[model samples]
Target: MNNLFHSLLVFATFLGLLWKIHRAFRRASPIGDGCVCGGELCLSSP
Candidate 1:
């Protein structure tokens, strides 16, 4: 019983770590847009 509980805990931790990594990657910008900094060059961009 204890072994099963420990395994589940380890699995949960692994899943949590994977979720954080996934979120980090998903939040990154691939467009490299200068509008992120509120620049004048991108002011005209919709």
Candidate 2:
């Protein structure tokens, strides 16, 4: 019984760490000034 409880505690901690990493990646964007190879396009037209 004691060993079972210890294993469960370790598993929960690992799961929490994975959740944090997943959230961090989800919040990141893939596009930015450096990411674009083409020159900037004007958003307004005269």
Candidate 3:
């Protein structure tokens, strides 16, 4: 039981971290811009 609980906790934490990173990336990148690379790597939208 303890092991299962621990696994769930770790999984939840990982998911939370991933969600935060996803949000950060979204904020860094503009919407409707299918580009992940920011700055010079990304092309300017017309």
Where does model 1 exceed 4 Å of error? Answer: 29-46
Q: Residue 17 deviation, candidate 2, in Å?
A: 0.3
Candidate 1: which pairs clash?
none
| TM values, all candidates | 0.61, 0.59, 0.65
**Number of the predicted model whose TM-score against the real structure is largest:** 3
The lowest-lDDT stretch of 10 consecutive residues in candidate 1 is: 32-41
Q: Is candidate 1 or candidate 3 better by lDDT?
A: 3
RMSD of each: 11.4, 13.1, 7.6
Best by lDDT: 3
Candidate 3 accuracy as lDDT: 0.67
The C-alpha lDDT values of all candidates are: 0.64, 0.57, 0.67
As a whole number from 0 to 100, the lDDT of residue 42 in candidate 3 is: 35
**Candidate 1 lDDT, 1-46, residue by residue in tens:** 9999999999999989976774465457564335344556444544
Model 1 whole-model lDDT (C-alpha atoms): 0.64
| Deviation from native of the Cα of residue 29 in model 3, angstroms | 0.7
Candidate 2 structure quality by residue, lDDT tens digits, 1-46? 9999999999999989976774454446455433432334312211
* Candidate 3: tens digits of C-alpha lDDT, residues 1-46: 9999999999999989976785577676666434554454234542
Q: What ranking of all candidate models by lDDT puts the best one first?
A: 3, 1, 2
